[model samples]
Target: MILEAVVLQVKKGMEAEYEKAFRGASKIISSMNGYISHELQRCMEVEGKYLLLVQWETLEDHTVGFRQSTEYQEWKKRLHHFYDPFPTVEHFEKVYTLES
Candidate 1:
């Protein structure tokens, strides 16, 4: 599995709007090919900061499949504007996991 991680710095006073827009945008992503799951986490210590983590079956599914498709345009339209500086996306593969 591939983990796509991004730190989103939402613009000031836009958290509520961003969340609402993200709710609608979530559907777009979940329907895409290779989409496993995703989670959006809010930072308590820092206002307007969010961590977005998405799991894909493969890296290409996100870098090429999703980003190249028309659906991504809609994703961008719905959510990109709220970022002050465009967020940088990074991908990773699991190394280890510990669970009780």
Candidate 2:
């Protein structure tokens, strides 16, 4: 699995609106090919901070498939304006894990 992580810094006072927009945007991403799941988590210690974690079957499923698709345009229209300086998205692969 591929993990796509984004740390979003929303503009002050725009958090509520951002969250609302993200709700709609989530539908766009979750429907994409190779999409496993996703989560939008709010930061308790910092105002207007959020973490967006998305799981994909492969890296290209996001970097090439989703990012290049027309759906991504809609996603950007819904959520991009809320960001103060834009978020940096990073991808990762499983290295180690422990479970009982």
Cα-based RMSD of the predictions, in order?
A: 0.5, 0.6
Predict model 1's lDDT versus the native: 0.98
lDDT of 2 by residue, 3-100 (tens): 99999999999998888889878889999999999999999999999999999999999999999999999998888999987899999999999998
- lDDT per model vs. reference: 0.98, 0.94
Model 1, runs deviating above 4 Å? none
How good is model 2 by TM-score?
A: 0.97
Residue pair clashes in candidate 2: none
Output the lDDT of residue 58, model 2: 98
Per candidate, the number of residue pairs that clash is: 0, 0
Worst lDDT run of 10 residues, candidate 1, spans 79-88
TM-score of each: 0.98, 0.97
Worst 10 residues of 2 by lDDT: 17-26
Winning model by TM-score: 1
